[model samples]
Target: MAAAAHQADRPATGGQGCRAMTGGDRDGAPGDFRLTRRQLCALPGSAALLGLLGGCAFAARADAPPLPSDLFGGTTADPYLLALRAYIWGYPLVRAAQVRQNTTLPADPFRPRPPSAAGAAINRLGHAAELATPLMKQGVAPNNDTLYSLAWLDMREGPFVLEMPDFGDRYYTVQFGQADSSTEQALGQRTHGGQLPPVLIQGPDQQVALPAGMVGVRSRQRYMMIAERSLVRTPADLPAVHALQRAMRLRRWVDYAAGTDLPAPVSDQRPLLAPDTRCPAPLHFLEMLGNVLRDWRPDAGEARLISGLRPLGLAAGRGFRLEALSQAGRAAAARGLADAEAAVRAKTFTLGRNVNGWSVNYGGSVFGEDHLLRAAVAMDQIYVLPAEEALYPNARSDGGGQPLDGRNRYVLRFGAGDLPPVDAFWSITMYFARGLMVPNAAGIYSIGDRTGGLVRNADGGIDIMIQQEPPAAPRSVNWLPAPPEPFMVMMRLYRPRAPVRSGHWKPPAIQKIGGA
Candidate 1:
C-alpha cells in the first residue's frame, strides 16, 4: 500500500497462529472456523458484522463488488460492511497512532533530532536511564528493570546504521518496528548474545555504507522506531549505564563511512498523531488508518483485507475521507467503528488465560498474521516484548477475584525467596487506567530488588504495601504506591528463569491486608 517497495514474496501468513509466530501455521484455515471469508461475510446484517469481527474483521465482504480499478471506486456498500472494514483496519492503525503520539514528546528522546544527532541527545547520547522524571503518562508499556533509549527512524532520509554495544552479562534489547508498531526485528543480549555489532538498515532509496563488523542487517519502513532497553540495577548503577548509553550511536550510512560531522539540533515540535488514549473515536481512528495504509507494507495475504478496506477511501494513497461517503455511508461507517472498538475491548480483557487474578500470557505480544489479536493486545498494552525477552503478569484484581483499587489496603507478601524467580531482575509497577504511572509522593513509580530501603518480613519473606495512604513507618518502607482510583499492577520478570517460564513459579496472590 505504501510507496516503499517491499518484497512481494514476504510470507503472507505468519507461521504463527492467533498469537505470535509462537503458535503454528494457520493456512487457509476457516476465517473463524468457517469454510472461507465468503462464509464469514454471509452473516445476517450488522449483528453479523460485530460477531465476526475477530474471525474475518477485514475479510472482503461476502458478495461485495469488485475493487475499483482506481481510487474513485464507487460503492453501494451498506453501513455494516463499512463498519467492519473500517474497524478492522483502524485497530492496528490506532496503535500506530498511539505509539507515535505518546513517544513524540520532546523530553523522552525520539524527538525530531536529525540522524547524526540521534546518538548525542541533549548531551546524553542515544539512550537515557530515566533517573528523575516520574513518568506519569507514556504511550507504550513501561518497564522499571531497564532504563530506556528510544530512536524513531524517518527512513525517507536514507538508511541509518545502529551501533550496538556489547552489553555483556546485562539484559538489554533493541525492538524495531514500523509506523504501524509491528515488532519487525529484535537485537540485544537475548538475540545476539552480548555481541557488539554495527547493524545496517537499508531505506527505500539511499546509498549507504555497509560497515565492517556490522554483524546484522535488515530493511524497514520509512517511518520506523528502535526502542532499546538497558538494564539499570540501582542509583549506583546509573553512571555506568549512562556510559554504555553514550557509546551507542545511530549514524546515517554515508556519514559513518565518511566521518561526516552531525548537524545541530533542529527546530519546533510536530503536530498531534492521535489526541486520545485507546483512540476510542471512530473518524479520527479511520483517518489514522488511512494514513497508515498509505505507507504501511501489506503482506501477500493481506490483499483480501485491503480489498475490503479500499472502498472506504482507506487504500494505500486514497486516504479515508468521511466527506467522500454519502450521509448514510458515513453514519454506517461510524456505527461499524464503534462496534469494532467494543469487540476489541472485550477480547483483550477476556482473551488470555486467567490465573490467580493475573492474565498470565506467554505470547500474543508480537503480532504476525492474527491482526485481530494484534489489535486487541495493542489496545491492552502496546510495545510489549515477546515472552522469552520478558513477561508481564498483569493484574487488575486480588487473589479472591476482587477488583483492585486503592480504597482498600492490600499486602502482597512473598514467601522466603519466592519473589518472582528470574535471572536478571524483577519489578512490580503500579499504573492506573488513565495514567500510565501512578503518582506517588516518594517520586517512586516502581518497587523491586533495586528499590532502596525495602524491608523483609521476619522469616526472610517480603511484604509489599499497596494502598493510597501510607502505612506505619516500618511497614511503609516496602510501600509501592497506588492511585486512589482503580489501579492495576504489572510484574515484569526480565530474563526469566526456567521455573517462571515453565509456569512452575507462580506469583503470590495480592492478599488484601484488612477487610476495611
Candidate 2:
C-alpha cells in the first residue's frame, strides 16, 4: 500500500509522542538518553553489566543516539511492547480495509462482482445466491441460516440511498458498519418490524441534505461495509429470497436524483490476498495498517492512542517503512507481532461469561475502548450484530467440562418448553477447531427450529444428537454431524429477548452420551 499524498498538509507530529521517564540520572534534559531493557539484553555478556548496575545509579548521557520510544516515555524503549500496542489498536481497521481492497479493487473501482462470486466492489452490493455451506470457505463462521448480501461503499462523494422493499413476514437485517468494523446500525424486524424507509448514509465530513422521509446515517470514515442477511426458511424458498434480494437497491444520491440509478455493474478483480484469509506477515500487517490509517479519521480517544505510535514511525498518511527503524527495533517489532496474534487467539475463547460450558458473548455491536476485545471479535466473527439483534454462544467443552471431541457422541437436551427464547429464530451450527465448517457425508451443516422434520420427544423435550457417524431413525431427525476431530458448536439466537441479553438465560449443556 502506498502512502497518501496528503501527508504534507497534516501536522508533522502529534502531542509529545513520548512517555516521561522519572528517577533517571537525577535530571531531565534534551538529548538525555539511557539504554532500554531490549538494548541491554541484546549486548554480549549483558548479565555481568546488569549485576554491576544493580546497585549503582548512572548519570544520563547527552551522547546517546535517539532510540525508538515506548508508548509511555521510558528512558529505554521496548520496540516489542510498542508493536503489540500497534497491532491491537490497528487490527480491526487493517482487517476491514484488507477485505474491502481485496473485494473491490478487482472491479477497478468501477463495478461490482457477481453475487455468486466471493465479494462485491466498492459502492455496490453483491448478493449471495445461496446460503453458506461447508464448501463455502470465504469467511470465518459463515452462518447457514441466511443468504448474504455484501457491499463495500465509498461515501466520500455524498450520501448513498439504500432502499429496502417491504416484506410482510420475512426476517432479515441490513447491518451498516464503518471502516473500523464498528457496526453503526442494523435495520430489520426488531428495529422496524415489517417495513422500513430508505436510509441515506454519508461520511463524517459529508454535509448533505436528506430527501424527505429518508432516514439519515453517518459513518466515522469515508469507507463503509454493508452486510445484509435474509433468512432462508427452507431450500425450496431460495427463489423467493433471491427476488427479495434483487429488489434491494443502493445508489448514489446524485444518481437517484437524476434518474440514472442502475444496478451495480458486474465485474471481477483478482484479490491481492488469498481466498483463505490467512494471517499476513508481521511487517506486512503493520504496513497494511499504516495504509488504512492514512484515510481513517479516528475519534478523540483513538486519536490520542494513535499519537503515541508516532515514535515507532507510524502516523496517519505516512507509510510504515522498514528503513525507519534500527536493526534492533525491527527484531523487537517482529517478536511483538507474533505475541499480539497469539494473545488475540487466546482471548477469543474467553469472551463474555462461560455458562453451561458455553461462552455467551454480548455487546459485539459496538466496541468502545476495548481494543483487544474488538480485535478478537474481528478475528472470529467480523460483523456480528448486537446482543438484542443476535447472541452467539459457542462451546468447546461438554457438560463435564472436558474438551469436545467428535470421536465421542454428545447430546444437547432442552427441557419441555425451554427452547432458546428469541423473537425471531434459533440455530446451532457445527465447526472445526479452526472455526470453519467441516464437510460431512450427511450434507448437514446446521440444525435449527426451521429444520425440516425435526423431532421432539412425546413429553415436549428435545435431544439433539451430535457425532461424526449417522444415527438411526428417530435420533437421526435431531442429529448434528461433527468432524472426526476436535470441534466447537455455536448457537445463534436471532432477535433475542431481554432474558438472553441480560445473561439470565443459558442454553442446556452438551452431555457425553457414550459413543467413543
- Model 1 pairs in collision: 83-336
RMSD of each: 11.8, 13.1
Report the lDDT tens digits of candidate 1 across residue range 1-516: 000000011001111111111001111111122224564344323232323233432233222122223321234456556556556445665455434433444445545533212222321224444542334122223445566676656665546677766788877877765555456566788767877577776765555556566754454555666677777887688787788887777777667667874632422323223333232233555666666666656666555566666556566655565556666666666656645654554455543666677777666355655555665565555556656667777777789887676778999889898888876678887765322456677776778877777888889999999988778998777888876655677788776887877788888888887654
lDDT (tens digit, per residue) of candidate 2 on 309-356: 766667776646566668788767766765665455455666677788
Best by TM-score: 2
In Å, residue 36's CA in model 1 sits off its true spot by 37
Identify the runs in model 2 with alpha carbons over 4 angstroms from their true place.
1-77, 105-118, 262-281
Q: TM-score of predicted model 1? A: 0.73
Off by over 4 Å in 1: 1-76, 101-129, 132-135, 138-141, 166-168, 193-195, 204-212, 263-282, 457-459, 472-474
lDDT of 1: 0.56
The 10 consecutive residues of candidate 2 with the worst lDDT sum are 1-10
